[model samples]
Structure formats: C-alpha cells, structure tokens
Target: MELFFTSLLNGVTYGLLLFMLSSGLTLIFSMMGVLNFAHASFYMLGAYFGYVISSYVGFYPALLLAPLAVGAIGALIERYGMRRAHASGHLAELLFTFGLAFLIEEVVHLVWGKSPVPYRVPPSLDGPLFTLFSATFPTYKAFMMAVSVGMLAALYALLTRTRVGLLVQAALSKPDMVEALGHNVPRLFMLVFGGGVGLAALAGVIGGNAFVTEPGMAAAVGSIVFVVVVVGGLGSITGAFVASLAIGILQTFAVAVDYKLPFFDRVTVSQTAPVLPYLIMVLMLIARPRGLMGTRET
Candidate 1:
C-alpha cells in the first residue's frame, strides 16, 4: 500500500512534467498547423542554458530567465526560418524543422559537449518535503508539481479570460478574419510559436535535473511528447494534458509492479514497462483515429 501511494505521487509529478512539454507542442501545432520536430530540441537547449545560467546566477534566476531566452530564439526561428518554409509548403516546413533539430543537437554538443552536465536540484529544494504512508516526497518534486499546476492555471486564465487569449484562439482557426479586423496575424503566429517553445524550455529547466541532462536528452524524451500529443489529440491542449498525466501515471505504476505475463515468463513486466506508452498510443490510434479530442479532418 505504501509502495502504491509512493508510485502514485511519483506518477503525478512525472505526468505534470510531461504536460509542461506537451502543452507547448500542442499549442504550436494547433495554431500553426505545423508538427514541430524541433520542439524537443528546444527542451534540450533549455536544460543546457539553465545549467549554465544556474551555475552563475543560481537556479531561481535560471528558472525565471531561461524560458524567456528560449522563447526569443523560437520567435526568431519563426520569423526568419519557419516563416520562409511556410511560404513553400507544409513539407518544406517539416523538413526545415527536422534539419533545425539536428542543428540544435550539434550546437549543444559544440557548446556543452556530449557528456551529461552536473545539473542538480537547488540545495534549497533538495531535501524531502513531507512523508506519506511511510514514503518521503522530495521538495523538488513537489515544487515541480506546483509550478506545473500554476503554469496550467495561468495558461487557462490567459486564453479564457483575456482579450489576448480570444485573439489567439481566433488566430488559430480564422487568421484571415482576425487579419481583416486589423490584427497582425503573422506576428501573432510568431508570438504563439515562441511562447509554445518557451514553455517547453521551462519544462526542460525543471525536468533536466529531475531526469538527466545530456546532449541526447531531447531524443530520449522527444518521441514520448509526440505520443502524448497524438494520443491526446493533435492541436488540443486539454487533450495533451489528459494524455500526459495518463501516460505518466501508467508508466510509473507499470514500473512499480512486478509480474510476469503468462506467455512471456522470460521478461518481467517491469522490463517491458518502457513500451507501455507506445502500446497506449497504438490502442488510441485504433480506437479513435481522430484522437480523444481531435475533430474529424476533412
């Protein structure tokens, strides 16, 4: 029972982290109609950037400023690179992002080397915060949960309660209509794209230390983010959130269980836990071709 509760807490924290990454990708894809292959690369960049910034200024400042820096880079990419690719077509845009992902990886290697950096939770947040059911929860993990929920709340408020939010939703489906109303649709697109990537970067800053920080960190988690987006529904933030938490909990609980399949006695269930997300994704694809919350494509 203690083990079950402990795994539950871990799963929730992990799920919230996945939401941080998936939310940004969902927003970018929904608004721009682009599957950003490079989104995870931005996450890797955030970790590297946060590590550097934290070394000099401390984790608090890195947490505050790293996302802003990453967002600015995303905005520039939209303006100079993606915008040009958009003019050519979706294929061109996807190819551009694919190449950009590699470029970011190479840049990370050049700047930070291929080794995992020493990115640790801040000393202030390193200790256990509380105990439940004979299980101790780390202060850092709780902090992550709070930050994730706060970001989720802030995003919801921005979109549902503010003029900018309305304009953003309008821009997603009716860019031309918004443009006709004297709004700058292209600039809004840039801002949305940038903001989305920035959110990913923020996830990296928090998740890097929680997981591992290395040149391959993006590739390590990149596919899962896409899976979350697809299972939840492409271009659906709410869907992404649901998928993220579900996957996180599913994976965490799978790891905690020790059982063997009737047919596959050679492999422990924990050994196969890594494949659970892909399995869920396959089932989702079969059951709902349009995704849990996605609209039918014409």
Candidate 2:
C-alpha cells in the first residue's frame, strides 16, 4: 500500500512537470504551427538562469526573472533567426532549431563546464511535506505540483477569458484576416514563440532543482517531451495534459515493479521503465494517431 501510494504521488508529480514543459510547446504549435526543435534548449537555459539568479537574489525572484530573461531571448531568436527561416519553409525552421540546440549545449558547456551545478531546492521547501504509510513525500514535490496546476489554470483563463487569447486563436487559424484588422501577425508570432519558451523556462526554473541541473538536462528530457506532445495529440493542450499524467504514472509504477515479460524473462519491468514512454508513443500512434484528446489526425 505504501509503495502504491508513493508511486502514485510521484507519478502525478512527474506528470505535471512534463505538462509544464509540454504546455509551452503545445501553445507554440497550436498557435503558430511551428514545432520548435530547440524548445528543450530554452528549458535548459531556464535552469541555469534560475540557478544564477537565485544565487544572487533568491529563489522567489529567480522564479520570475529567469523565465523573463529566457522569454526575451526567445523573442530575439524568433525575430532574427526563426523569422528568416520561416520564409524558407518548415525544413529550414527544423534545421535551424536542431542546430540551435547544439549551439545552446556548447554555450552551456563553455559557460558552466561539463559538471552538474549544485542547484538545490529552497531551504523553506526542503523537507518532507507529509507521510503516507511510512512513505514521505517531499515538500518540493508538492510545491512543484502546485505551480503546475496554477500554470494550467492561468493558461486556461488567459486563452478562454481574455481578448489577447481570442486574438491569438484568431491568428492561429486566420493570420491574414487578423493582419487585415491591423494586428501585427508577425509580431504576434514572435510573442507566441517567446511565450511558449517562457513556459518551458518556467518549468526549468522549478524542475532544475527538483531533479538535476546539468548541461545535458535538455537532451535528457527533450525526446520524452515530444512523446508527450505526440501522445497527447499534436496540438491539443488537454491531450498533452492527459498524456503527461498517464505516462508519468505508467513509468513510475513500472519502476516499482519487478515482473518479467513472458518471453524476455531476463528483463524486469524496472529495467524496461526507461523505454515505457517511447513504447507507449509507438502504441498510441499505431492505435490512435490522432491522440487521446487531439482534434486533428497526425
């Protein structure tokens, strides 16, 4: 019982973290039809930025400042680099971003070295939040869950209840029409890209200390994020949310179990946990290519 409950909690927490990262990618794709290959690089930047800012000021201020700094960088990238690539087509955009990922990684190596930085959780949230049947859940994990939920709520309200959201949605489906109405469609695209990466950075700010803060962190979670995005549906926020939690729980439980497969008796479930998300993605694509809550076919 204790293991089950602990795994469940851990799964949800991990899933929400995935959502925090995926939501930004979903927004950018849904709004601009641009799949950012360098999205995880921005996430890595967030953690490093948060670490530096927090060291100087504190976690609270770093929480706000790091994302803003990354967002501004994202805006500049979109304006100068991505904007030019957009004219050349999707392949150009993809190649640009793919190369940008390597560039960011090299920069991190140059700046922070190859070693993992000592990015610890805030002292205030350092201890266990509660105990369940001898299994203690960390306060930082609870804090992560709260932030993830809060972000979801805020994003929902922004898209559904605000004028800016309406414009964003309008621009998504009808960019020319929005531009005809005097809206700067190109500028909107820049903001959408910036905001998308900002969310990724926000995830990095929180997740870096929760997990590890290293230069390779982006590469580590980068593929899983795309799995979440694809499994949740290409451009569906709700689909992403559902997929994140499902994958989170599935992998968490798999790590806890030791059952062997029928034919592969040498491989335990725990040993296979690392491959679970990709396996699920493959199965999802085969069974329902549109994804759980996705509106369009992939």
Candidate 3:
C-alpha cells in the first residue's frame, strides 16, 4: 500500500513537470501554428541559466529572472531566426527549430562542458518534509509541487480574467478577424511566444536539480514533452494539463512495477527500469488519432 501511494505521488509530481513544459509548447504551436522542436532545448537552457543565477545570487531570484531571460531569447529568435524562416512556411519553421535545437545543445556543451552540474535544493528546502511509511519525501519536491500548481493557477487566471489573455485567445481563434479588427497579431504572437518560452524556462529552473542539469538533458526528455502535448490534445490548455498529469503518473507507475510473465519464464528480465509510457503513447496515437483532447489539425 505504501509503495502504491509513493508511486502515485511521484507520478503526480512528474506530471506537473510535464505540464510546465508541454503547456508552453502547446500554446506556442496553437498560436503560431508551428511545431517548435527547440522547445526542449530552451528547457535545458533554463536549467543551466537557473543554476548560474542561483549559484551567484539565490534560488528565489533565479526562479524569477531565469524565465525572463529565456523569454527574451525566445523573442529574439522569433524576431530574427523564425521570422526569416517564416517566409518559406511550416516546413521552414520546423527545420529552423530543429537546427536551433542542435545549436543550443552544442552551445550548452561549449559553455557548461559535457559534465552534469549539481544544483542542490536551497538550504530552506533541503530537508525532508516528512516520512511516510518509512519513506522520506523531500521538502524540495513539495516546493516543486507548489510552484507548478501556482504557475498553472496563475496562467489559468491570466487566460480567463485578463484583457490581454482575451485578446490573445481571440487572435488565436480568428487571426484574420483579429487583424481586420485592427489588433497587432504579430506583436501579440511575439509576446505569447515569449511567454510560452518563459513558462518552459521556469519549469526548467525548478526541475533542474530534481532531475539532472546536463547538456543533453533537454533532448533526452524532449520527446516525452511532445508526447504529453499529443496526449493532452493540441491547442487545448485543459487537455494539456490533464495529459501532463496523466503522463507523469504513467511514468512514475511504470518505473515502480516489476514486469513478469508466467508462461514466459525463459524470457530474460531487463536490468533497467520500466518504460510503459512510450508504449502507451504509441497505442494512444494508433487508437485515438486525435488524442485524448486534441483538436488542431497539422
């Protein structure tokens, strides 16, 4: 029972992290109609940036400033890099992003080297919050949960309660109409794109230490972020949220279980951990092409 509960909690936590990354990616895709292969690369950038800032300053300030830095980078990329690629169309945009992802990874290697950097939790959040069923749950995990929930709630409120949010949504729903109505959709796109990048960076900031801060970490987990976005449904915030949580739980539980077959006694056991989420993602796509909540085409 304890083990089950432990796995459940871990899953939820992982799901929140997934949400942080995928939510931004979905928003970017929906608004710009571009698939950003570099989204996860930015995530890796966030972790490294957060580590640098936190090392010199402190975690709290790093948490606030790192996302802004990432957002600025996103805006620059959009203004120059993506804008030039935009002339050629979606294929161009995707290729641009893919190339950008590789450049970013190489840059990370050049700047930080190929070694993993350890950024431990802040002193305040270093200790265990409590012991459950003889298992210790670290306070940092709770801090991560709080940050994820807070950010999600803040994003929800912004989208539902603010005029800027309303205008952004309007533009997304009817770009032609919004442009006809005299709103600067281009500028709005920049802001929204930057905002999405910021959110991804923020997730990276908090999650760096929880996972590992390394050069290729973004590429490693990048596919999973894509899967969450697919599972949640493209361009649907609510769908993305649900999918993120679901993926987190799925991965967590997958690692916890020991796979065995009665009739397959001769089959050798794999030494590594579980990996059922990828299989589930494949089946989900095959069975539900639209995903659990996705609606956008192409």
Candidate 4:
C-alpha cells in the first residue's frame, strides 16, 4: 500500500511535467491547426540555453530569460519561415517544422556537443521536502508541480478572462471573421505560436534538470508529448491536463509492478512497461477517435 501511494505521487508529478509540455503543443494546434513537429526542439533549446545562462546569472534569471529568447526565435520562424510555408499548405508547414527539428538538433550538437550538460537542480531545491512511508519526496519535484499548476491556472485565466484571450478564442473559430473586425489575425498567430514555444521552453528549463539535458533529449520526449496531446484531444487544454496526469501515473505505476503472465512467464511486466503509453494511445484512437475531450469539429 505504501509503495502504491509513493508511486502515485511520483506519477502525478511526472504527469504534471508532461502537461507542461503537452499544454503548449495543444494550444498551438488549437490556434494554428498545425502540429508542431519542432516543439520539442524548442524545449531542448530551453534546457541548453538555461544551462549556459544559469551557470552565469543563476537559475532564477535563466528561468525568465531562456524562454524569452526561445520565444523570440519562434516568433521569427513564424513571421519569416512558417508564414511562407502556410501559403504553400499545411503539409508544407509540417515539413518545415520537421526539417527545423533536425536543424535545431544539429545546431545543438554544434554549440553544446552531443553529451548531457551538467544541468543539476539548483542547491536551494536539492534536498527532500518530506518523507512518507519511508519514501522521500524531493523538494525539486514539488516545485516542478507547483510551477505546472500555476502555469495551468494562468493559461486558463488568459483564455477565459482577458480580452486578448477572448479574441484568440474567436480567431480560432473564425479567422476571417476576426480579421474582418479589424484585428491582425496573422500577428495573433505569431504571438500564439511564440507563446506556445515559450511554454515548451519553460518545461525544458525545469524538466532538463529533472531528467537529462542532452542533444537527443528532444527526440526522446517529442513523441510522448504528441501522444499526450492526441489522447487528451488535439484542441482541448483540459483534456491535455487530464491525459498528462493519466499517462504519468500509468507509466510510473507500471514500472513498479512485476508480473508474469502465462504466455510470457519469463518476461516481467516491467520489461514491457515502455510500450504501455503507445498501447494506451492506440486504444484511445480506437475507442474515442476524436479524443477524450476533443470535438469532431476540430
């Protein structure tokens, strides 16, 4: 029972981290109708940039500046690169991002090399916050959870409360109508894209320390982030949040359980744990084609 509770807590924390990544992707997809293949590359950039900036200015400042720098780059890509591709078609946009992913990886290797950088948790959050049933919970994980929750709340408010949020929502449904009302739809698209990338970078800033910060980290996490978005629903932030938590807990608990089935008596459940998320995704597609919270309208 204690083990179950401990794994539950770990899973929730991991899920929240996944939410931090998936939320941004969902937002971009919702607004632009584009599945950003390079979103995780921006995340890797965040981790690498944060490591370098934090080494000089400290983690707190890196937390602020790294995302801003990445957001600017994303804005530039949208204005100059993605905008042109948009004219060519959605396929062009996707291929552009797909190529950009490799470009970012190559640049990462050029600048930081192919090894994991020393992106350790800051000393202030390096110790355990509390212990339960002989299981220690790290302060850093708690901090990560708090940040994810806070961002979730902030994003919810921005979309539901503010005038810009209202406009963005309106634009999502009727870009032409919103443009007719004298709003700059293109500029809004750029802002939303940049903001989404900023969110991804923020995730990278924290997640890099939580896991590993290597050139290949983006590729490692990119597919999972997409699965979370797909399972939760393409355009639903609420769905993404719920799905992230589910996957997080599912993966963590799966790793803790050891079982031997009749046909595969020699193979432990843990041995196949890595494929569990994919299995869940396949089931989701079969059962709920539009996703748990996704609308067929999307």
Look at candidate 4 and give me any clashing residue pairs. Answer: none
CA lDDT scores, all candidates in order: 0.89, 0.92, 0.83, 0.92
lDDT of 2: 0.92
Per-model TM-score on C-alpha atoms: 0.96, 0.98, 0.93, 0.97
Q: Give residue 178's error in model 1 in angstroms.
A: 1.2
Report the Cα lDDT for residue 260, model 3.
Answer: 62
CA displacement after TM-score superposition, residue 188 of candidate 2 (Å): 0.9
Residues 239-295 of candidate 2: C-alpha lDDT, one tens digit per residue: 888899999999999999988977996998899998999999999999999788887
Per-residue accuracy of model 4 over 63-96 as CA lDDT, tens digit each? 9999999998999999999999999999999999
Give RMSD to native, each candidate.
Answer: 1.4, 1.0, 2.1, 1.1
What is candidate 3's lDDT per residue for 57-142, written digit by digit as tens? Answer: 99999998999999999988998788789889989999999999999999999999999998777898898998889899899988
| Candidate 1 C-alpha error for residue 279, in Å | 1.1
For candidate 3, report its TM-score: 0.93
- Kindly indicate the candidate among 3 and 4 with the higher TM-score: 4
